[model samples]
Target: MAQHGWVTQTQNPARTADAWWRDAVIYQIYPRSFADADGDGVGDLPGITSRLRHVADLGVDAVWLSPFYTSPMADAGYDVADYRDVDPLFGTLADADALIAEAGRLGLRVIVDLVPNHTSDEHVWFREALAAGPGSPERARYLFRDGRGPDGSEPPNNWRSVFGGPGWTRVTEPDGRPGQWYLHLFDVKQPDLDWTNPQVRAEFLDVLRFWLDRGVAGFRVDVAHGLVKAEGLPDWAGEHGLLDGTVAPMWDQDGVHEIYRTWRQVLDEYPGERVLVAESWAPTPERLADYVRPDEMHTAFNFDFLETHWIAADLRESITRSLAATAAVGAPTTWVLSNHDVVRHPTRLALPQVGRRPNGIKATDPQPDEALGLRRGRAATLLMLALPGSAYLYQGEELGLPEHTTLPDEARQDPTFFRHNGEVAGRDGCRVPLPWAADEPAMGFNKTGATWLPQPESYRRYAVDRQRGVPGSTLEMYRAALRLRKELRLGRGDLSWVDDASDETVSFVTETPGGSVAVVTNLGREPVKAPAGEVLLSSGELEDGQVPTDVTVWVRQ
Candidate 1:
């Protein structure tokens, strides 16, 4: 492959359809912020089709899109009203078909978001549930229950919403009186579906087959741990455990595994060996292992890896734990750094605060040092990509985009902000539109110069057009690393720690078919002697034959 050019490779490669996802580098695209084709300020299917070339050029095996399902825009499309059709906010079903076709033409596969835990309040079933009254079959499809107080006024339990407030909401009876309460673990606009209902199970299975027929390679199962609740719907005794990985009755129930097993059968019915990846947050790695038990999903996000602090020891432990946990179930671990819901890793790595989730920044909070963060972010990227499994790249990370941390209060759209009464700024900072052109309106995200979320002025420098083809640019660095990762077949291998590494450094060797590659990351503040091998790539500029601070180097041993 040319140093500045891309090498085109077909996905699946006649190398056994089931093995492609084992080590695939899939790119995650949050559609609303990716690009806008019709100048509607929101990214549409056509816009994504236009930009598939960019993802293809990055050498990713697949693109895992966030939801574009028909919805009322509650929870940013996660609350799907219609699972079978595309939202007008994105485009029509035809546009989605075209996107799949275009992606295939570019040697990339499409894995769409599958939101099965909840449905928008506007969904036909939800509306029917409300109209049919308590104890009706329609209401049985959701988690509707009688309230605790006199005349059923108060919620049945003390369960708190993941966003904020009580997880239950009281509904008015058809007789114009206060009535039973319904559960919505997320925003009240998203009511949780009752997976125990046979109707609910059958409906989602059909929804899966409908999309599978549309030529999608797989699904990035949203809230994969949340479909089932413990029997009797008991309330938790302690705090809502959204981030601390607490085992709530509302998540990671045993029944969810059966659901995925059924879904796996549906995927097997397809020709391309379609996959299902869980966004599960179980209480332990062993518990998480249940979701990918060979007959279930293909892989799951390693939140342990993503949430690990920048410390080398913490990262090494997380990586080892993840590898061992998944290996126990004969599955590959999926490594991810940043996604739509969290602060971008660049900014997160710069902060002294190491919260499990990115607490949105306030103007009064200590600002991140961008220079320091970018160096660490690059190093972390190289370290993650060098690991021995599949990897996911969030869009805009290639351009080294930091979170837009200073948006005005009125501009925030994340439901978490409103639910928390602004005590948390919410995740709007990380969902700002991507910068495609340095000077164009909305950073070339939309020709109309408007976006659903405002873009920061700082985005101009990190725009795609500004960095493309620029030597040593973050974009180029990603392209080069991805190309080399494919050439080295680094993703498919076994990884073991290097014994010679110091405490401040995390070192591992990946034994691949082609060669054994050593990866070293110096998290310390001083340069380290280069490992004894031929240097292939470095996250930061190397110093006189040494790895600089906050740098990761790949060595062909």
Candidate 2:
């Protein structure tokens, strides 16, 4: 395989000379679930540092660590309390520095998560603002409004919070007079900052520079679209009365581009090699492209694929739409099949027609055929890594981990569950601690105590130590897929969907400057004739010239 150097300049619009992320595969590590050192029973920076070898061995170019900053854990660290220091629960600032250094030693670039749209109420700045009177300068730092309404009886508007209630919270003044109301789009503890304020914008830009100066490679900006809001603060009409309405007008507001432009300028002060990935939930290609508009985010997660219906037509449409939209904005596209916030892909797409479990749990299972489900899940993994754009592998996803949503009410950690009346169970399942040893207590994620979240009993069958040397294990399959992606130029190539002659199959071809490769998959239950090609790799047992059912084939010509 020939190594392609970064293009400093390019003549073709589809090809960029300086896009470092074009060929990069990023592994996402949810800090509290990845690994726990010091027997804390919760994952921390030191735990992640010790596990860098596992990430590097997968051949990924970088690792994107989900938020580990000082926080109240309201949204699992998305509600940041301190921008410059590591939370004591995770480790000290020194542990973070060591993690960065260790990742570099393994040739893996480290990208930290930055949550700038809101801050934890415990944040010093938010506390100071609350302590100051209405006339104080600190009051302008957040969205504080006088009184509740014109009648002074209710909230100013019927805005609903994302977590399922009124977005506004009224606070009384220290002198016994009624103080102003504060806005929180997610949780009341995570009050939204007033981006309209110049001082607020300047302060966040300084935070960006702070990390860039610390030798960190880049950031995964949380809620990139939620940075700015409609300045009028008008009440949204349609779902205005519901708790979900609070974020309607403010989310993905067009005015956000201005703020992103400012952040891009601040990022430009550093070297061009640094990366910025935005977590925008907008599924449309045009909307997703807004975050990666050449100068804004270096790349944005193309969540359309992650949320796409598990059908051939839907998958093809997502890829085509994503490619066209990214090309229009002169930006490259990145693909993610699973993340901390969503159901695992294996469980999401395993069955042809999967729905909520009988108990109404999204990813939990009561199905009759468990072994078949696991096999199909392995098939989904092959499809995800073979796609053209940059791929994001969630923590423990490579081991075919299924979501564990059986935690009792008292054990549920997600605040969204309580806030939404359990209508939205939240992301607790995907955030469970990773299992390293099958027989060890807590699956070897901890030594002496129980984990912050319960480890699944099924983890005993799929633990890393158990699969490390198994040839056909899910862990080995992941390593092979990743190596094939790198050695065959599938990550940096032109992608085209093949017109399948049969309804039961899905296939595509990838072409790079070096060579071309074709991938075909029998997505059906029955065996299908292999497409005419030289087979490079097969998912199932392959005889001399025959392919097995539910198999994926990679071939080079």
Candidate 3:
């Protein structure tokens, strides 16, 4: 490991299946809020490129950037208007290229988000479909069908959008009459692409090449389980719950595996072990493993682990099931706590009730116990990193930043907020611009332009400048943990449950250099007994040689 945890150029020169990603630590960067290099309040490629050093200092192996492609911002950048180009809001293509080069220079691999299931309404293909009218080749590229009613005024089916409201949006004909409807699993502005259309498949393949040619190490495939739908796009009665429900016809269809097999072949054609990660949601861990079979993707996000509450039994089950399923296919398991799309873990763990599924917190909502949430969050992270697989860190998470739970409704931008008729506040709370300088304007997220999302004043204490070298600070804890994790090769270690584990706590031992290290976590109120060992790193101070509540300790037994 070099200064930035980068391998020397001579290392892995053949670019074979080095499998670096198997145990890698990737940091997800939501560029809209990462940093603003220019005077613009919104973050751009230059902003991210400049601040990447901070990410490198955290000792992550790579950076996973959310969509920065041309978009209408209907669902942030998820409504991608053009996959081959960068959005002006983020910067130019040259800027993207420079960012990739800079990340490589820092020994950091870059992984860009790839939205293959859908395209923005403003995308040229969608625009062409709109102009070409129904029954045309252009219209064939998307899921366009006639309305169900006699007058063709109603939607084609009862399928609901993940963002609420109707999934099928009726489009007027070129002659200006109410015509056929297009399927949009998410926002109305994001129409689902018809994978059955050969041209559509060709276009996305080209998009992958364009970015890979630009020097991105790989892609985080958005809706990886959704490139294909059921035969007739049949009606589904249940509400969509990606992180917590049975698979739907419109999601995790078997046909998706065929697409990934092709994608895997394309990825293997390139050198440097270019990887593909699936952002998939399935009915079970076994089903999720299908997306990462050796012939398909390299890995899939372990959402079951992410959705599990801070319970010992649940966490152990999720981890065991995930590792077993992924191992069955010989693929690495990917662990993540928070991302731009979800509420921060600290806030999620601290909240008492589950009023909202994916919608973020609000000022009017019951506020979470911030200190308790953070304590548990740190404990959870230590336990996660100690597990045997790759891990992902959300931006600002290393600083122990909680979701902006008090963000006013007027400042909200996530489409979920508007789609739910303001009844449910959205993910904006977790996407606020990060606080880099406690004393600077907008916490040093930007120089002059107004932040796309307002930053909470409480972020001052969690600012990078405030915690840079402070002992016991969340940022420093993450740095130390990452350093130790790599030095001890903990990600590749064999894991086994400790005999003394109880219902309230998880106790496991993992093979290390000379012997094995024990990881013990206390989730319940009562302090639990821990195995006698020298403390290597602890999420919190050990109390009287016992593991305190919301604490996780790594000990050399």
Lowest lDDT 10-residue stretch of candidate 3? 6-15
**Which pairs of residues have clashing backbones in candidate 1?**
none
Candidate 3 lDDT over 173-233, as tens digits, reads: 8999989999998999999999999998888788888888888889999988888888998
Best by lDDT: 1
Error of 3 at 431 (Å): 0.3
Clashing pairs in 2: 7-17, 160-246
Query: lDDT values of the candidates?
Result: 0.87, 0.75, 0.86
Better of 2 and 3 by lDDT: 3
How well is each residue in 306-370 modelled by candidate 2, as lDDT tens digits?
76655566666777777777777777678887788876666655544544322223334343334
Q: What's the TM for model 2?
A: 0.91
TM-score of model number 3: 0.95
List the candidate numbers ranked by TM-score, top first.
Answer: 1, 3, 2
Q: What is the lDDT of residue 98 in candidate 3?
A: 91
